[model samples]
Target: MGDPTAEANRGLAVGPFAHDGVWLRCALHCHTTQSDGMLSPAMLRRYYSMGHFDVLAITDHDQLTPAPDAHSEDDDLLLLPGTEISLRSPESGGPLHVLGLGVNAMPRVPERATLLETAAAVQAEGGLAFVAHPWWTGLRSDELGDLAGVTGIEVYNAGCEVEQGRGDSAQYWDTLLSQGLPMLAIATDDHHYPGFDAFQGWTMVRAATRTPEAVLAALAAGHAYSSNGPDIHGIWIEADRIRVASSPAVAISLLGAPPRGVRVNAGPHGLKQPGDVPRGADGRRNGAYPGNLLTEATFPLLTGSPYLRVEVLDAHGRKAWSNPIWLPARG
Candidate 1:
C-alpha cells in the first residue's frame, strides 16, 4: 500500500512498513485436555513456553479454558484466552472452526447455523475471529466471499498437515484476497498432541509487550506473520520496489493469484533445483526438494497487482508468510 493509514483501513498494517513493535512468537490456536488435545492446561503452558513461544492462546473447542498458573511470576510467556467454535458451514456442508482470541466469554450468534454471523458475533464480543483451516474444512474460496468480520485465516494448520496432509491453505487465502478482500493469514500449530503435532506452525505477532491485550491488539492490527520455520525480519515497500529480510531462504517470492508476482531465487538462471535439494541427500529424497536459501532480497512491485504478500521458502520446505499488502488502486 502506498499510504500506511489507507493500508490499515484495508487490513494491511502487519508488515514492517513504518511499523513499531517487537516481534513475539505466538501460538494463537491450540487445544488442551479441556478439549481433544492430549496436554493438560499446566503442561500446555510449559510446552509452548519451552518451545520458545512468547504467547499462547488456550483455544479449546467452544470453551474458554483458563491458563494454568505459571510456575514463575517472572516468566514472560503471555497466555491469552480463546476458544475454537465449531460452526456449521452450510455452503461447504462441513463444520468450520472459528478461533476467538482475547475474549473471556463466547459470543452470542443470532443465527448459530451461519459461520459469518457467528464470526461477527465473536468480534462484537471484542475478540479477534479467524477462519481456522479452510482447506482442512474443505471450504471453497467463493464461500469466504460472503463471510465477514474475520481477522484472518489459519493459512497453515500443523495438526491438519500432520494428520491428513491437507494443512497448507495459501491458495485458499489467496483466493479470498483475489476477490478484493483484505484477508489476513496466520499459521498455527493447532497442536493437539504435544510432541507430534505441536510446534509445527506458528504466528509471529509484533506487539509492544508480552501481554494478552497487546498481542491480540497486534493481531487485530494485522501486525504479524505466519511461519512453519523461518523468520521474517522486515518488509518495506517504496514506490515500485519491495524489500524483504529474513532468515536464510532458498527463494523469496512476492505471491498473488497467478502470474502477477515475482520470485528471487538464490541461484542464478534458476540454478536452484526445483526445491534446492541435493541429489541423493537426506532432504526430500522421495518428495520434491523444498528450495534454496538467501537472507535478503529486493524486487520491483508490479503495477495492477491486486495483492502482494511475501513467502520465504527455507531449505526444508518450511516457510514464513507475510500478510498481504494490498496495493492501492492503479490509476
Candidate 2:
C-alpha cells in the first residue's frame, strides 16, 4: 500500500473509509450550558446519543466543557474535549470563531485575540483547529488564507442556517482549494438550542476504532466527509478517473474553481433548464440543479490539474462533501 499520510494529504484515501475501518457518525461541533447553549453537558450527551451519533465534541464558546465521564463509560459513545474561540478579524470587522477539537486542555486565550494567535494556542495544546463558519463570521474567503495552523473549516454550519440562513460555506472551500490550500471542510450542527439546530449537520469519519484518538486521527488525515443528510459510502480515485457511491443523490459534482468543475445528473428530467429545478418547502431548489436522483457517478480528470473535490446533492436538498484532492499543476 502507498503511504497513508501521503494519500490523506492528497485528500484521496481509497477503500480506507469502507474496508479499513468502520464509519463513525460524529457531532464534532456543538454547544452547551458551559457557554450560551440551552442544554447542559449531560443533556447534550443524551440528545446526541439518541440521534445515533457515535462521537461528540462539546465546543462551547471560549470554554471547554468535556462530556460527563459517565457518558463515555458506556461503549456506545465516545466524547472528545473541544471548545470554540473567538478572535477579531479586521477584514470582516467582526469576530471569527475557531473550533478546537480533541483538545487535551483549553488553550490560553487573551482577553482580545487574533485568529492566528488563537489557532496557534490551540494547536500548541495538541488540538485540531477548524475555522468555524467563515460565512457566518462575515469573513471573505481570502481572509482565511492569512490564518495558519487550522486543519479545516465548517463548510456548513446548521445553527447559522436556522438563525440567519448564512450557513452553507461550500464556496469558501472551493476558493481555498483554488488558492492551492490543502484544507479540509466539515459540516456541523454548532448547536446552541437543544432541538432546533440538533442533527441538522454532522461529520462522518472513517477510523480503525471508535476511540477519540482514532476519530481525531481520521479527521487530521482527511479520512472523512461531511453532510447535512446525504451519506457517501465510498470514493474511488485513480490517476485520471474517479468514482463515487452515495445515497440517492440528484447530482454528483466534481468541483474546483470556475472552468475546472463538472457534474452528472440522473433521472427522467434529462438536464432541465436551470430555472426548471423544482423548489423545496424552503423555496430553495431541491437536489442539485438539472437533476432529480442518482446514487453513483464517475468522472475523468485531465492530468496535471490543480484540485478537485466531490459533492453529492440529494433529492431533499441535503449534500455530502469530500475534502479536496490536490493535483499537480499543468506543466
lDDT at 212, model 1:
81
Candidate 1: stretches off by over 4 Å: 1-14, 268-292
| Candidate 2: pairs in clash | 249-294
Q: On residues 281-326, what C-alpha lDDT tens digit does candidate 2 reach at each position? A: 0011236544446655666763444777888888788888988776
Residues 1-331 of candidate 1 have per-residue lDDT tens digits of 1222132322222364457667788888888998899999998998888888889999999888987888676566888888998877667678788898887577776555476787777887789889999999998776654567878899999999999999999988887888778888889999898778988999888786757888888888788889999977667665556667667677777777665777766654343444442221111111233434466566666666688898988778898899888777664
**So what's the TM-score on candidate 2?**
0.85
What 10-residue stretch in candidate 2 is worst by lDDT? 276-285
Off by over 4 Å in 2: 1-19, 71-75, 268-292, 302-305
Residue pairs with colliding backbones in model 1 are 14-222, 249-293, 249-294, 250-292, 250-293, 275-291
Per-model lDDT: 0.76, 0.77
